[model samples]
Target: MNKLLKTISVSVLGAAMLSPVLSTVVFAATAASEQQATRNLVQQLSNIKSFSANFEQTTKATAGTKPAQRTGLSAQHMNQTFVGEMKVERPGKFYWETKTPAKQTIVTSGKTVWIYDPDLQQAVRQTLDDQVANTPALLLSGNTAQIMQAYRVAQPDQSKTYYRLYPRVKDSAFQSLTISFGTNKAPNMMVLLDSLGQTTSIRFNNVKVNPSIPASVFNFTPPKGTDIINQ
Candidate 1:
């Protein structure tokens, strides 16, 4: 996998599966009140047992290393979009299918994650634990206290529905994340900014919260001729 795809497999899939495969431990890095607010937000998210949505994802890659140069490069690649659909269930189950720009499916059964690309005729498998660990806001499955330990949460707009998170872990893949919740208290969109200065924003449409999602959707059997790459 190239740098972009590798980053996507972690952030995109991880954010999309936040209600499931997340188990984190964070510290209190922000104000006590802010911590409490983040906890409240996470608590609301944790209450969702299942969800489904049609999505539109846009990724922008910024060039150059210096901040000024990156700012200029960001404008040139800010409009690329990919459309998809996703379903997630708590305690380790998720299914995501990207239909435009590329065709792919990613599924996880809490224990393992599978990434399949039909065009490439390849299926890659990795432990679900590792993938979720590096994904921001994945603290929903963990205790609220842990969320404070891992991220510095800020509600820049002071709206109960929007939050921006900065990861405390040095090895984390993304630099920061912003999440917005729908009136139903389920995630409506997530924006992830990675170390490479690439930003991926996913917006959800036709969202269904606490819907019935079957266990079968999280399991995948590679086709007879597909190459299986175990990680």
Candidate 2:
């Protein structure tokens, strides 16, 4: 799942983890126009009623005992918050859905956060408390100012705005985060780096700036004959 994040971030920074990781895909920008353009983009984002995008996520790490990283796709919706279906592996095997507002319900499968598998019928619910770990949630829930608190905001090139951020807590799980905005001025891509020096990168495409989506997408109803796990 950690590796999956790196891939999805290529498209959506709407994920909010504790230390913070997010960004829009690269858009051309000029040094003279950086601050204003960014401000305009933020303002535009704040006014958006809905959004939909596709993400390509990728991850990498040093070879050896360290975990070998890979990537995948995350189809997403950014309303007041973020909700999406993503497969961490192929054939859409591992799918994670996000629902927001409650922050509590963002990753829920039922009243419980983890879904019960009828085959196993056993699911354990664990609160991934460290917001840094819930990058997707924060990315969709927060604004630019909130993100700036922990990251050193940088505009790397005339066409690219980047953010280099780290966790505020010394013991936070991640080492750093990088977010990139598109030259056209959209918050579209992000990259996360963990303490192990592993990196995950995500990109967004086919975006809908402000469109309508089904409310049911954010609601969770447990499957039939499944045990509700609360832990």
Candidate 3:
């Protein structure tokens, strides 16, 4: 997986939303329908008992080159058993683990949100909201309040009923964000374009509504002797 995803603290992955297999793949909807559906799903997210899903992602599309592919698995419960895991085979094979409220991330070979390279030599730290925006977890988790607070939600082009997200705070990290509904009922995919026009796309699959998972999934304890640092 891309080491960068682990940065979402949702990599510990950035998440929220329904899965492709779960989503019906909506072709188009009336403007009002799109708006209402987006709003409805946003509300449904908060009420859903528990959720789980799998997804595929590709970062940096290059001409004549196959994009790096990744598989993501995530699950969240009412009390925050938020768990998202992503595996990417690229420059190398890597994994991302996240726990919320704190929304922490641990990366490969000594890098992370919880553990930084210059990370005071192996201590864990907390990530701020700006850092939080970079995660796929936030998108997948479907925390509309958090999403609405951080991004100015809009529909840029009327041709397609896609919901676009603009970072309200205005930072150098990303240029624009857009997410699409699979069947005008459930969220299926997210496309994030950074300042460089380089894009990261995540598609949700195998969604399990009202899942029967446990809260322990969201909790983590670092290896013994691993340093601890709090932001």
Best by lDDT: 1
lDDT of 1 by residue, 99-136 (tens): 87678887777777788999999999887564463444
For model 3, state the Cα shift of residue 31 in Å.
4.7
Q: What residue pairs are clashing in model 1?
A: 26-146, 26-149, 26-150, 27-148, 27-149, 27-150
Error of 1 at 226 (Å): 0.6
Give the distance in Å from residue 163's predicted Cα in candidate 1 to where it truly belongs. 0.9
Worst 10 residues of 1 by lDDT: 8-17
> Comparing candidate 2 with candidate 3, which one achieves the higher lDDT?
3
lDDT of 2 at 176: 66
| Tens digits of per-residue lDDT for model 2, 174-220 | 66665665544454776766665545656667655545555454345
RMSD of 2: 12.3
Taking every candidate in turn, the Cα RMSD to the unseen true structure, in Å, is: 11.0, 12.3, 12.7
lDDT of 3 by residue, 1-231 (tens): 122342120111222456678974444433434455456446644554345555554455324433232122222211232344433221111234433323334442212234433223455555434454345434444345666566655543444435666666665455566666544334466676654334666666665554555433343456666677776
Clashes of 3: 25
The residue-level lDDT of candidate 1 at 123 comes to 94
